[model samples]
Target: MGIRVGTRDDAEAIAEVHIASWRVGYAHVLPESVLYADDFEPRRRAIWSEWRFAPTQRVAVSVDDTDRVVGFAAYGPERERARGTTGRGELYAFYFHPDVWGNGAAAGLIDHVGERLRAEGFDEAVLWVLDDNPRARAFYERHGWHPTGIAADFDVHCELSVPEVEYHSPLTVEGRP
Candidate 1:
């Protein structure tokens, strides 16, 4: 697999990975209705189509031998700013095709993301994972992320929410994780 900066042309492929990963990875944590929603793919495509990268915001994707995106990671300046912390970034989203799990594509994307965030002058980075999604949480942990004891309910739709815990890692060390 190869890693590269995502472009507008990759919107559809990224959406495919996003939807597929959510469907399989969150199958147990989220309701089937939400995961398999009829409008999910279209909505994802639309969202990705509107994605734009900036100085502190960017996305990287992992592609297979055929150059099809199989995983992606989106990151930028932390959305939920914390007092006294200006060098913190946030891993807004991370997803990979279920079939690519355990193949190290996710690891490659994450490493590239970390290097970019560090080069951008971010000292640390944060990400939220569903509290019940042990598989994902473990993956983050294995990559040097640790829970920050910060928990919140992420509301997806009307009256539907899921608990998520924050994880953080220092980006000061080059080639770390």
Candidate 2:
């Protein structure tokens, strides 16, 4: 697989990966209605299209040998100023096609984002994950991320409210971990 910066043409594939990952990753954590929504694809496509052109966000995509986008990661300046941290970047989103879950695509995309964030002058990086997603939590932990004891309610399509926790990692000059 190859990792590269995302472009406008990757919007649709990124949206698809987002939806597919959520459907599988949050199957038991989110409400059935939210996960099974018939309009999910179109709505996600629209949102991703906007994200693709957003000036503040940096996005990257992981593609297979055939050049099909299999996963994506997005990051930028932290949006929640209430976190009380300055010079912090936030990983706005990260997802992979369910089929590639066990592969290294997610890790590679994450490393790319971390490097990009470090190059942007961010001192640290933070990301939120569903508190109940043990798999994701473990993944982050393995990458040297730790929860900051912060918790909040996350609305999934405004249809379900789930608990989320924030994970943080300091970015050094080398951007390792």
TM-score against truth, every candidate: 0.92, 0.94
Highest TM-score against the true fold, candidate:
2
Instruction: Return the TM-score for candidate 2, rounded to 2 decimals.
Output: 0.94
1-177 per-residue lDDT for model 1 (tens digits): 999998878888888888898889888888888877787777788878875355556889999999989999889888854334555888989999999899888888888888988887788889888999988999999989999998889876557899998899998576443
Task: Give the alpha-carbon lDDT of every model.
Answer: 0.83, 0.85
The collision pairs in model 1 are: none
Tens digits of per-residue lDDT for model 2, 1-177: 999989998998999998899899999887778877887777889989885559998888999999999998888988764366666899989889989988877787777788889888887999999999999999888877899999888877855688899999987666744
On the 0 to 100 scale, the lDDT of residue 36 in model 2 is 79
Per-model clash counts, in order, read 0, 0
Q: In terms of lDDT, which candidate is strongest? A: 2
Which residue window of length 10 is worst by lDDT in model 1?
79-88
